[model samples]
Target: MFTDLALGALGHPRDLPTALELAARHGFGGVDPDVGHLRGLRSRTQVQELADDLTSRGLRWGIGGLPVSLTAAPAVFAEQLAALPQVAEILAAAGVGAVGTWVKPMDDALTYRRNWRLHVGRLALVAGVLDDAGIRLGLEYVGPKTFWSTERFPFVHTLAELRELIADAGAGNVGVILDTYHWYTAGETPADLRALTASDIISVDLNDARDDRERDEQQDQDRRLPGTTGVIDLSGFVDVLVELGYDGPVKAEPFLSTLAERPVDDVLAEVSDLLDRALAPAQELSRS
Candidate 1:
């Protein structure tokens, strides 16, 4: 795994060119593309220019957020799905292999069974479009009782359930966006990760939960930078990914508001340090 820069995910958003330059300047290996920013590139030539920028800096494009929202109305979903080809073409040309989105774990309308079928059908369509462009689709599971437990339908919020959705999606390009926060909150173990091949995952989000709360009591929005708190078993999770030979970008997605209020350069440098420090010990020990 490599440290990836995702300023927007950390509550500090930057334009694509600025993000790439800052990532390289701060020593990041990859920078996750902002799809909205990418949408402005009108042609393959523009994308090539962007890709060349990345190559020049010895950097790579990390996973982009799937532009389609899972809970969109049928018409809205169709509209977004329709625009995907152009998006995919640009991304594939720029050497971005995969895009990711989260499975909405709760639904006030459709029950789990109904929601599952909707997902299978729609994502099969999304994956088909992405497949043609040689891009893969990664689905993330949202685990946290606070998010899914209520007087509503709780859907796939666990890794196993996420896989079930992928299996049902029945597309070769479908994969997982396994986040350390959800894995720990779902009570998944190293053995769970051991079961996956590197190809089954498109990316990983490294983060830590609040140390004062029980796993189930944790709020999804309240998170800490990886290695800030040992409340989650990051070592075990990282070790398993290493043993499995996972070579994807692993970024921190701590939802702290303080980061948003800080200077972009300072925040990026600090987050870069946090993510690098989180992975350094394991890598050093392995080399030793």
Candidate 2:
């Protein structure tokens, strides 16, 4: 997998043009596409220009946030769903192969069974549109118990449960967005990664847990960049990806609110360097 840059998750939400420049300068192999930046381009020519810019910078298009909200009321969902085809087409033409969104681990109202059905049906429809345009949709599961336990009803928060959810959807284009924070919190092992084929995943997010926190006490937002704390087996995660022959974007998604306090340049360089270090073992394995 290629090291990708996710600006917003790192608290550096800049325009796509600026993001691209930063990504190139910092040695990111890929950069997350801004859906808004893409939608702003009215014509195919504009989209091609954007795609060509990525090519010129030697950057791959990374997964984008799903524009359609899965948890919206039926009417609101239908409204958002209506506009997806246009967006999907633009993304497809721009050569973005994947887009993703997270599933809420808990709900105050809907029980697990109800939520499952809602997600399956909605995802099938969404996947249908995306698949038509040759793009895939990835769904990330919220894995921290600290966050999920807050609501009255709990939903899928484990890799196994999310895999079941994906299987239930039965969409060829629907797959997992594996975040290391969730994988670690869910108590999954390298075996879980080994069990999955490359096609079973759409993307990967890397993060390290807090050193002071126990596994169950881990908060969703409390995270460090991969390999910084050695609290997460980020190297093993990368090693497994390499062994699986997975070829996709693997990005650091440390949702630390304090990231905004640090200099953006430092954050970008640090993330890039960390990913390089994390991937070093895997790189050596591949070369050998």
Candidate 3:
């Protein structure tokens, strides 16, 4: 697996070129660019220039979210769906092969049953657009119980449920974006990883949870750096992915407020060091 940097995890704004340079300087193999920032580019040549810059720095283009909101009202959703084809073309031109977004937890306005069905239909449409442009779509499920308490019905909070949703969506180009924090919060085991093929996973996020909090109580923004806590089996998770022959990008996404408060350089250095330790076991296993 390759190391990637999610610009969002930095909790700060950065342009595409600066983000890429940071990724290269901090030993990341790739970076997930903020596609929204590139919406102003009106020419294919501009996209190619960004791609060429990434190539020059030996960095791969990673995943980003589509500009459309699939969870809105029917009319709004349709409008977003209609615009996705153009977004897909732009992403394809930039050499970004995949995009992803989170499956938000249950909210007051939507019931679980309705939300689930809505997501299946919406994602199917998204998958069609990405497939036509030769791009992949990664779907992430929120695992925290705090949000689940708001809805009376069962929600998609586990990897198994997330997989079911993908199957229901019936899109060949769609897959999961596995996050260590969510995996642990949802009580997913290493066996879950073993059951998955490389094709089932589009990308990965590496982070740890606060040891003091219960598994179900850990908040998203309170995450710790990988290998800094024992709340998640990150090494085992990596080993399983390695054994499964998954070669996608594995990015650090610690959402700690302290990390956000720190200098960007310091945060990058710490994340790079922690991730190296977390992946060491998997690297050794691969060599053997």
Candidate 4:
């Protein structure tokens, strides 16, 4: 697995170039650039220059975010969909392969039944755009039950449900962004992961939760760095990925507010150290 950094979760955010530099300095293999940065580039030349700069630093460009909302109204959604070709062109030029977005839980304005159907159709549209550009879509499921209480309905919160949704969408190029925090929160075991092939997972996010918090009580930004807390079985998680032959980017996404307050170098150092420890078993497996 490639060691990657998720810029958005890095306490204080860094621009793509700076993030790439820090990633290389700290021994990371790749990084997920902020989509907003790519969207800001004025031309294809600039995008290529950025890509070249990453190459020069010996850093891989991992997945980026999709700028469109998958659950927007038909007309609004079409406008967003129309903009993807330009985005895809830029991503293709920059050599980025995948774009990801979260699948939020249903709310009062959108019932579960309606939202589910909307996602199937909308994701099909997204899949077409990305597939035509030779990019894959990494769809992430929000696993915390606190999200479920407000909706009081069955939402897509598990890997099985996400797989079924993707199948329903009939989007051949789409897969899941398997986040360890969400997997642990959802109460999925290593046995659960064994059922999935490597292709079923598009990418991965690694982080730990506070040991004091109940599974449902953990907030989105209340996460710890990998292996810092014993709340999640991170070693076993990586072991399963190794066993399943998942050769993909595994990013650190600790959302702790304290990390944001620290110096960028210090934050990156802590993340780098913990991630190496978390992935040590997987690395050994790879060598064997």
Best by lDDT: 2
lDDT of 1: 0.88
Q: What's the CA error at residue 140 for candidate 3, in Å?
A: 0.5
Error of 2 at 232 (Å): 1.2
Quantify all predictions' global Cα lDDT against the true fold: 0.88, 0.91, 0.83, 0.85
> How much is the lDDT of residue 259 in candidate 2?
89
Superposed model 1: Cα runs more than 4 Å off: 285-288
> Which lDDT tens digits does candidate 4 get at residues 1-288?
888887668776778888888899999889886677887899888988999988888888778998889877788889999999988878888899899998886566677788798899899988999999999999988887777566645578888788889999998899999988889888898988888899988899998888898998977657888887888998788889988889888888877777777788888888888878878887887788
| Candidates by lDDT, descending order | 2, 1, 4, 3
Estimate, for each residue in 22-91, the C-alpha lDDT of model 1 and write its tens digit. Answer: 9999989899987787778887788889999999999987899899987899999999999999889878
Per-residue error for 36 in candidate 3, Å, reads 1.3
- To one decimal, what is the Cα RMSD in angstroms of model 3 from the true structure? 1.6
In model 3, where do residues sit more than 4 Å from their true spots? Answer: 285-288
Q: Is candidate 3 or candidate 4 better by TM-score?
A: 4
TM-score for each model: 0.95, 0.97, 0.95, 0.95
Cand. 3 TM to true fold = 0.95
RMSD of each: 1.6, 1.1, 1.6, 1.4
**lDDT preference between candidates 2 and 3, better one:** 2
